[model samples]
Target: MKQGTKGFVGADETGAGQGATGRARVPAQPGAEDVGRQRNRTRGGGTDAVPGRTGVDGVRGERTHSEPALPRPLPRRPVQRSSVRGQILAALRTALVTGELRPGAVYSAPVLAERFGVSATPVREAMQQLTLEGAVEVVPNRGFRVVERGDRELAELAEVRALIEIPVVLRLARTVPAERWAELRPLAEATIRASSSGCRATYAESDRAFHRAVLALAGNEQLVRIAEDLHRRAQWPLVGSTPGARDGGARLVADAHEHTALLDALIAGDPDAVRSLMEAHFTGAV
Candidate 1:
């Protein structure tokens, strides 16, 4: 970046993915690399490499054509064949949340493999897994596409969360020992700190952990899984918006308060109050 040049500077930790801090995780995608490549190609005009560090008559010059932007993680690390499928799935999940693969966008395994610099076998396997999860759609001959999320559908899912989770929190408040609440307070605080520091990924994780900790008291693995997935999928909207945007941040803060209230109600054995707070907690927008 030159003293008065107009341009962008972007840097991020390599390979951190969505677990970077503790808010809602932003799924990883290829935006940074792709955009940088496009910009360099466009500005340079010819196929010559844009030297990383250049000198002109002993004066260093790094031209810029945009404003400072968000950090972007480096390319993903290499993976073994055995875990390639899981890697692809993780990649796809990030892309979906980040809106890189828009709803209805067709997916071609071979093409995706090439895009990710991997083998098609793994890509195919990932597509199958995503299809089963209802995150994507498969056509007989057209391959797959990311599914469009409808507001009504999301609301319904949110309702289910309210029903299932609020009561559990209430019960846990009544039965779970006080020590457990003390143990989770740090996690919640850490999540808040992560969000304040603009570590959206970390904030998301901590947020999930806080909610999961509340539900863990129920001791129902199947219900827990369902709740986790629902919460994760609902993050798609936030990923499309700016990290820690005010609306999402406010919602998150409110959720934390709800957690506190639920805990209070649990410890007091106020089941009805707990259920009401829980309903309001999950049904609220992000």
Candidate 2:
């Protein structure tokens, strides 16, 4: 960024998605590719961020869903015969986020394939990809088991998000057309409304949409894709057994309000304010 004195020097990674060190956790899992193309947004939980330098190389291979945000993953029909691998990956991610695939429960590729009405190959491949995200653990002579990530991981994930998202947004505040950013207001407002509604899933999806809209301003598809992957990671479900698992409506409302403020700062083209706002948003998140 030329000693941090540049104006929108690089594309901002905003998405329909990651934490600082950990990935941006989204709900109702979808393939990284599908998340990118569909611009799926998600709500995140807390765990320390484990920043991964994941890019959008393989994910961009096949662009999928062009549909609006999904509240949950719908089962695929048996006759569907498109990119089967991507479908399985997306399905597993949805299962993971929605608690259909329980943490600590063992699931074999064949069983999951049966559920999705596909072959075992894609299911195994998708599970392998998830293994890299620390979403599941592989066992000898057994299938994969969902991994339980803790708050520490979520915090680290937030850190990674701050590193990736904040600066780009700040630059965008300086360089991007104010009108362009302003156009995203509806999406941001939807997040606030969803948050205020007190439904966790709706709020989560809206939250992801708002963030995705924010980064879309940079006009960089790849950046958005990478950011979306990170976002999904951060939104992965938290272990219910964890102490202090709070999901009160008050917190969502407050977070939604912050989203409004962040949008205002961006639309106002206040880079300094945008920086502070982005920082507060990332750090304040669990």
Top lDDT model: 2
> Tens digits of per-residue lDDT for model 2 on 103-191?
78899988888888888877888889899977999986789989987788888888988898897788788888878877888888898
User: How high is the lDDT of residue 145 in model 1?
Assistant: 76
lDDT of 1: 0.68
TM-score of each: 0.61, 0.62
**lDDT per model vs. reference:** 0.68, 0.72
Error of model 1, residue 40, in angstroms = 79
Candidate 2 lDDT score relative to the true structure:
0.72
lDDT (C-alpha) at residue 15 in model 2: 34
**What RMSD does each model have against the real structure?**
23.4, 24.9
